[model samples]
Target: MGIPRTPVRGVAALAALAALSLTVTACASEKATGGGGEASAPSAVGGDGVKTGPGVTADKITIGLMTDLTGPYASFGKSLTQAQQLYFEQANAAGGVCGRQLEALVRDHGYDAQKAVAAYTEIAPKVVALAHVVGSPMVNALKQRIETDQMLTLPQAWATGLLGSRAIQVTGTTYDIDMINGVDFLTREKGLKSGDRIGHLYFEGDYGESALNGSKYASEKLGLTLVEQKIKATDQDMSAQVAAFKAEGVKAVLVSVGPRQTASLVGVSLAKGMDVPFVGSNSAYSPQLLPTPAGPALLKDFYYMTAGTPISSELPALKKLAADYTAKYPDTAIDSGVPAGYSAAAIVVDALKKACEGKDLTRAAVVAAHRGQSAWGEEFGTIMDFTTFDRPASLLSYVAKPDKAALGGAVVFEEATTSDLAREYRVPVG
Candidate 1:
């Protein structure tokens, strides 16, 4: 769980979810190797004399991270991992977690499913759980492996399919609910009539599919005309999809996509003389969007619906965290993914504290503690009742428009919303 001044450079597992290059400094730990070190690590064998889980010794716990640092989503992955590192570093600075230091094993998948699987295979054997991972496609591809191992994971994928995994923990909203509420915001606040045409564009993976489910549900309930198009993760051009929507004469667009495609969609749509509004799901807006050649086009059309507090919220805790994180990283702006990564690590830290109450610190104990929570909220906007795993712990989201001046190029938050209908949907475990 602990390594002293260890530098984990790229080791051929997963890519940073979004950043191009990653730099991490391991926290110092006394039980890093357990050879009569100055700090005492919890013994692998409890007083009961039984062996414990993988990546757990007398004094440390090891966790894994699958990022997309070198891929299309590299910025997201990199930002997430950096924030995670910072969170753990802070925890260590505060005297480690329950007398045990947390160690992170990170790999870059470059957004490739096969690479994700390989990273999981290599890292899983050395860690107690996956603190976070990159893409929905990769998670889906490795579901069986994860289930078979019963390993605890804080997934990067916000898909409904994760609802059934006893080993996974999610407190924030899901993509489907966020998108549903997004459309609801559009209809209620953005001046869209019930029957107005709303075009849709999404990826073919769990993340996009989940968002599509929400948009579809909203469109059906609100009587909006729905025109849908699916894109691949590798796709950089969206002219065809834009053409299709323009041909449909859609009044606006709903995107369950990401920044790269968001830019392409806006540029192509604008170049085609179709300047309709575009509302995106939480993960759609990337910091790079506003700096791109298509930045102005996006500024003219794109808005985002976030599953948690917008990284730009003026809420006291978020504000402090954003300020502190930026101060620490200096060069990086506070983005949506930074707070997300920090909170995800917060949940793990809390659960680990619970598991170590009796000094057991077993993987089973950690997973059980996570699922047994009566109420869980990272004190960000989202809150959860883990009473069951049929749905995300919560389904609250905020609506924000893309602005160049925002710290992360994401600005403006106009009240958060949660759909009542989303609560009625069946979230399946796969």
Candidate 2:
């Protein structure tokens, strides 16, 4: 069966309408407080006169980790959780912040929206901030509640639509920015030219739609045709999408789905003799795929864009992180999530430290501290400025390819960069 096609113009129009709706929802909501109204009241007072609120105590501060431990992205979530756990352990050993030991409260939502909402509801009153929330849809489902509760959160997902909430901070370049850069790489280095038809296989929600926004913009700017295949996160097979792309005579394909989908897309495309380069959103690739049957095909033509440095980077900070992670986890295979998790934890830690210095450790204070950060983490990958809430922390991305011999099963092919188009692109904040 042939896949139904929506005119590119129609798709772009719908995406614009959706973005406008999200923007209004984000901007018109009641401004978040220090804590969810009553929850903002100080729970305890430290000897140093540091005011505290929910999740803060005289002896400890608790942060929540809402992740997908048993879901489709389990590999990414588990590695992210482990790396965060390691960072928290290290922080606690170093006497923690604000004279209190840090605690991580982990809850598995399994990538279910209802479960994520339930988990957030149950855990919100107990955490001053979230170290990391794993999925874009999960984050979107909980955005209003998070705003009402005034909890500071760092999301692992980077869809641009998630912006506008002061409480939710995306630590890296947004999906749209990454896609713009990816398209630039294809045009500049991969022999793609104007008028070439390209395929985009994306999930149906915020993550994929946001990425589509970039491809649409890039297609128009570069005089290319974009063929889009929208899928659900639950859909793992990509044979149908591959067939559609092949029928369209697309020159290359971009994926904004999960690792399973990426593997299927690459493997099926190769099998069908539809051999074209595949570029994917960061979440679309996992190191675990390296040992799978699709591994060789992925290595041949697949690359991904990321806001964080690859785990195999030779930077001193990354090297130390790898060594420490190996020492701590022992048997767990290191992946990109190691640095991604640690970088997020580091961001939260920096905010907490800032809040501590001000002697106000309330949830609101932490949010303020985060917003006050103008520059952060050259040690992680790219430097990020969190001073603004309507934009991503950074616009740079690292392009990486799979490598079985690499610690993370991937290595950086291009260091952090923001193409002219990426820099010129105005991300939709809604």
Candidate 3:
């Protein structure tokens, strides 16, 4: 998953039933009670006058976050998790949804499919909804279970294959959409032209494949040749891939892998003097990489696309978020994940608030509330329309380049905008 930039602004796996041991982290706000020392009465309740369901109680609501920590994407996950915790803390301070304190049940899957399943199975019965689930493979592994429970889940993934599921809401543009816009940027701004060969280095699963689909569509639409190179999440060395692209004489490269792989690819390519421009999906970059050996290489020719505003933006919401987060986590480094996580939690809170209005906090009611949202706006990014599940909430993407001195280590070069080809391209549904 990637962070947001507007003009900035901003998968699946199978189930393995192996014995899994995991730690469940809890982040909750101080409990609040009525003036007379009685637990606050719920603003509304179900028809039976008792509104209760998994993770929802008279005085508290629990939401689950399944993310990657101590894994390849740990940097992204840790920052995202912290931002969500911050949001929940603020919400609780302001009197949580339906007059109940909000609690976040966080479990780290370490980006492993089996661990993700185990974590979900353990937390599913204790949460009203999922605020965030990271990794396309992890989400894909739990897709059927999520649907069966009718749980409203916000995945930190953008693969198009994850679409069409009412229960799984992808918060922003899909990976394909980002790539479509990315390809356009290369042609229109980076000096690539029609008939030029474009190489794509992507992971093998839904994340990469879905992004590849977009590049394929863009190439076909604009008369470019796409050279494909598929890699695994575990693959780090990109020397061979760079050699191949060099041989193919590709003018540009699109990446759909994680930050580590991105570093390797760019660093190796630069070392070999393969100075072509590189664009990546949101998942392909991390602020943590700015200090690494590949930092210079990435800064020179690497760009990424996302659906949210960058943390360095002058947007008021983003500024406030940065200030609050810095105060809360004095020792932590701010990154794109801060906005990404906060935006996601904001969406979940919106749904919960809507559900409260109807006097229902049941899992099904929460889902309904989320589906009712249309043209929902967030200060950190573009407007999102969630009434439908077949396409992205927004199509606009921000093009950004890594900046060593910037907050989140990135600065947007192209504000949020949609390419004509992207607008015309049909989004594939599962």
Candidate 4:
């Protein structure tokens, strides 16, 4: 929907699936394991209506991922795919899911909607489930298809409607919920009193539109005024749009655009002397976007929201995971999207672990085993919880700002936020 930023870009280059039936009713039929535990790997049944991956075997479990690796969002796809790969490598190093190595069956869609459909079609019948499918539209394209096949599609992008379906699970806060949280926190904690105006600049797409609507809904709930601007994803210049917002004299700006466009907006905003603090959706926060002169000027007063726990948080377990990740693949960015990818990938590992718990790996048994599994407290944060019932997750999010410690010259944490209205600010750390 929006331009692909680093996180989105990485996912684009790295990850696929086809149309699955939306029918989510659980049914059971007796099916035998292929052989003794090691030889009896999971197999696809006949010419399938949808795609499926080969399942649990004595040695490895094949989990498929469809991402935007080559087309519009290649950078995002690449980063996300690397993240998943690293996580799996780490998990594999630790003996993998349920004593079986987790092997990712990744396919790239180049962020094309049709390609995403085709990718899903090819991978559906081969893997146990789809792990960390990126993009709002790409995932949207295959939602019903995944459902019909009864394959759980753990998503990295936030599209709230997917929450109501059985086949899709999210790793972080929904767009609406994250927007409301940011809006509420800004007002309640940051002291943005009534009468203050906020401006929104977003590209026109499902990603941007969802963000716009979410911001609108939050603005109404928070009793704030919102000025809107729409930009084409292909538009590189934002001087005119910045001029309009500057003319309005709003106190803050909320941006939802890809890295390239976001850079253009920041450049235009700074050139125009519109020093109002900016708030952005997940799209704007990326290490690749920063590191230029434009980064400091535009991002200095910028605040963004995210659906995952920061690597900087003082959680011992998560810290250990991060440390291990760093020790192995010293080059991964491990920023916002990477953690989201890891968390989503981890859940698939959980599912596989459950599927292979007591019996040999078989399609029928793996599907049956995962029927009512709940990941309510795996410790990924409030955004990712699974239950056999009841919305599974709290859908919480955190407010973060840029810092020096984050990878690629971008760091984020709650301790970095500031409110220009109240004159309250957190200490800035390099």
TM-score each candidate. Answer: 0.86, 0.89, 0.89, 0.78
Once fitted onto the true fold, the runs of candidate 1 whose alpha carbons sit more than 4 angstroms away are 1-44, 47-51
What are the per-residue Cα lDDT tens digits for candidate 1 across 1-430?
A: 0000000111221233222233321221211121121222323665544335676665666777776666555566666787888888888888876666887777877778898887777777677777787776777788788878777787776777777777776556777777787787777767888878999898886777777888888888889989999988667778899889999999889877766677678888888999788888776777665555677887776777766676676777778778778877787655666877888888887777877775656677778777778767656766776657767777777778777787666776666667676666655454
Across 1-430, the per-residue lDDT of candidate 2 in tens digits comes to 0000000012343354345334423432221111222233446666889999998888878888887665555556666777887898899999899898887788877678899899888778878999888887888889998898788998888888789999999877888888899999999889999999999999887888889999999888999999999998677678889889999999999988877677778988998999899998887887666666677788999999988888788889999999999998776667777888888898998899999999999988999999998889988767998888899889988999989999888899998889999888988996
What lDDT tens digits, residue by residue, belong to model 3 across residues 1-430? 3222101000000011010011112121111110112222333454546466777767778888887765555656777788998999999999998888888888878778899998887778778889888877888889999998888999888999889999999977999999999999998898888889999999887888899999999999889999999998777678899999999999999988877678888988988989999999988887666666777888899999988788898899998999999999887778887898998899999999998887788788889999999988667767898999999989999998889888878898899999998889889987
State the TM-score for model 2: 0.89
* Local distance difference test, each candidate: 0.70, 0.81, 0.81, 0.60
Evaluate model 3: give its TM-score.
0.89
Please provide, for model 4 over 1-430, each residue's C-alpha lDDT reduced to its tens digit, 9 standing for 90 to 100.
4323442112221221100001100100011011112222235422322222354544566677776655545555655666677778878988886556777777766667798898777666567677767777777788788767667777666645455666676555555555556666667656676778888888777667767766787677557889999988677667888888888888787878775566667766877788777777777666655555456654577767766666666656557767766775575445565566676676666666665554434444444555455544346554344553124244455777766665434444463222232122111110
What ordering of candidates by TM-score runs from best to worst?
2, 3, 1, 4
RMSD of 1: 6.7
Score residue 10 of candidate 3 by CA lDDT.
4
